[model samples]
Target: MPEVVFSVDQSKSMRDQAVPGHNRWHPDIPVAAMVRPGDEFRIECREWTDAQLGNNDSANDVRDVDLTHAHML
Candidate 1:
């Protein structure tokens, strides 16, 4: 199993704004306050199904993407 740590950023430049990305349309939260000593966390940090595909990409090209697995993190 692997682990990822998310440290809270208290930078003065931090702002309350919407994050633009896949599944991230909401306002950003204070990362420092979210995680606790034993809280569980995991993220699928891999190339998405549509990453290298172009506008003319076909259905077969989009299928069978290697989805990220769940490891202890």
Candidate 2:
């Protein structure tokens, strides 16, 4: 198994990450990781909605989720 270069804690927000990731892409956004070509590595990420949607059979979370800071990268 490849070593994990980046990891995410589903229980927390992107900003709370040890090396916080960004939702948007920009040159100003610091590089989260760097690897040599052909390097096998892993990056664990949370849901795009940051788990705004629930696991149960309910669509309310989807309907009411505030996507103001979503699509976590």
Candidate 3:
């Protein structure tokens, strides 16, 4: 496999949701310090849903999501 390096943001926003198949949103640790020129890796990212919610939305089908449940991830 081709080696790759990654520089990720580990903020709470970057943390993974509790989706059934997936565990966390991002890697447990940072790899920017350990990655070499040829190392390859994959990155998991959060969805835009968390960022695009309005206060008016209250129902499950509403576009405005509270992001309260991990299943939304």
Candidate 4:
């Protein structure tokens, strides 16, 4: 994987908001705080089961989803 760096802006409005879907990356604490200009990390992004479930799947699949084992994109 290639190295990634974040340059974030910390403004008053942003401080009160949260990053959707990522509890760990709150607006108050920008990604810049955790990474430098040349740091690298394995980033994993995942979607809600309800959002990605196939048409053939039942609602039960979403209800039964185990967040702990959910796939990361």
Instruction: Name the top TM-score candidate.
Output: 2
RMSD score of candidate 3 (Å): 9.9
TM-score of each: 0.21, 0.90, 0.25, 0.26
Clashes of each: 0, 0, 7, 0
lDDT of 3 by residue, 42-71 (tens): 544444443344344556445545555433
What lDDT tens digits, residue by residue, belong to model 2 across residues 1-70?
9999988887888888888868888999889889999999999998888778889888898898888978
> Please, what are the lDDT tens digits per residue for candidate 1 over residues 1-73?
5345432222211122132123233355334324557777743332343243335758754564433421111
C-alpha lDDT score of every prediction, in listed order: 0.35, 0.87, 0.41, 0.41
Candidate 1: which stretches are off by over 4 Å?
A: 1-52, 69-73
**31-58 in candidate 4: lDDT tens per residue?**
5335556666643333443134445659
So what's the TM-score on candidate 1?
Answer: 0.21
User: Lowest summed lDDT over 10 consecutive residues: which window, candidate 3?
Assistant: 14-23
RMSD of 4: 11.7
